[model samples]
Target: MNKRLLSLLICLCLFISVFAGCSDEDTKKETEETTNEITSETSGKTEPVVERGTLKSFGIVPDDYVSFSAKMFDILGLDTKEDIYVYNVPQEAKVIYIEAYSFDGSGWKNVWDSGAGITAPSHMSGEIAIEIKKDYSLKISGDYFSSTTKPLTLSENIENVTVLKLDDFWEFELDKEVPVYMILADEEKNEFSYNLEDYPSTENLDGVDIAQVLTIEFSSEPL
Candidate 1:
């Protein structure tokens, strides 16, 4: 009887030891997994920085509007009413100029120039509203001013056309009823003009490739 009791106690001790060993191993594995997760969450993943003088380009489709703050327009010497300019610029352009152009059936003519010498900020870059008039393309020249404005064609075409949000004009209240000209252009570079007072109603510009747009001559009197 004594021998059997001793044998039973030994078997119980062995089972308890094996169970404890398995529990310890599981705990250790769980701890290791948690540690790995924490390490991954707090480890090295950073964004690369862009150097100055790097050239970049952006595209704007009709009906889509971009936004920029008033301070930036101030640097460009523009008195934007909505306190926002409808265009995108380089985060840090060495030189920047916004111009309005009219594409005659033959060539593009400069209508308004938003004098250059404006540099953009890296962190808080503003937005641009893409609005195009009938035959106008807003030309933003700077950064690679000479090259970018050069048309995308290898045929030595030079036309960096951009559009603006029309709401920018509708919301723009002048000191008086000013004579404004809305310039619009199309894909073939054909240009046209419209009077701001008789502004055309905004239409669903779905299949319209209206290039750049600009509003020139906000005059208290007639232009």
Candidate 2:
């Protein structure tokens, strides 16, 4: 073969190799971006979606009320507020309380409690003003007098008690003497009275699917 022809062929091959290398790099970059997108969606880190500019109004709902978890503010890239108001609480509920806490080096430190100012009866509207500093955690709680009940105490007879399941035909055993009056509420928030002293252990819930038990209280006091 001619030397010139041979040299020309070698240069062409080198050019093709370079072109193939560039294409592979581009393909690899595209694949990486696609993978990242999938990962973000699956991992619950997708871009936040809001209804119009509603959330942009700082969740200050008008006739209707909206509540924001602390993380919601962070996701929106807004400056943390020193105070926030909760609106549109259920009318049936008697008390609305907001708690603010700051995370210390070790644990959460209670910073503010709305209960100090907002009391029952007059504050039944469920609207509350919570004072919080930047980087503080906030929690809102409301209680309806009718729905308020006590948490049943663990009977000593049942040494090993575990909340096997919630609101289901869960399995639990009773055997011990309870000093405090026990209260149990069903799924519909209907109260059921149980006292080991009055009721016999043989009170057969045999066929009953222990499910639908919303809460059980040992003492009559609300928890």
- lDDT of every model, 2 decimals: 0.37, 0.33
Listed per candidate, the RMSD to the true structure in angstroms reads: 17.7, 17.5
lDDT of 2 by residue, 1-223 (tens): 6999999999999999999999999999999999988898788522322343233221122112234454476468665432233232223333223332322334334444343222344442333222222222222233322122222333334232212111111111121211111122233323333332332232432222121122121111112
TM-scores for the candidates: 0.24, 0.27
Q: What's the lDDT for residue 182 in model 1? A: 42
Q: Largest lDDT belongs to which candidate?
A: 1
Enumerate residue pairs that collide in model 2: 151-217, 151-218, 152-216, 152-217, 152-218, 153-218, 168-211, 169-211
Error of 2 at 161 (Å): 28
Could you give me the TM-score of model 2 versus the true structure?
A: 0.27
**Candidate 2 — which residues are off by over 4 angstroms?**
46-97, 100-112, 115-223
RMSD over all Cα atoms, model 2: 17.5
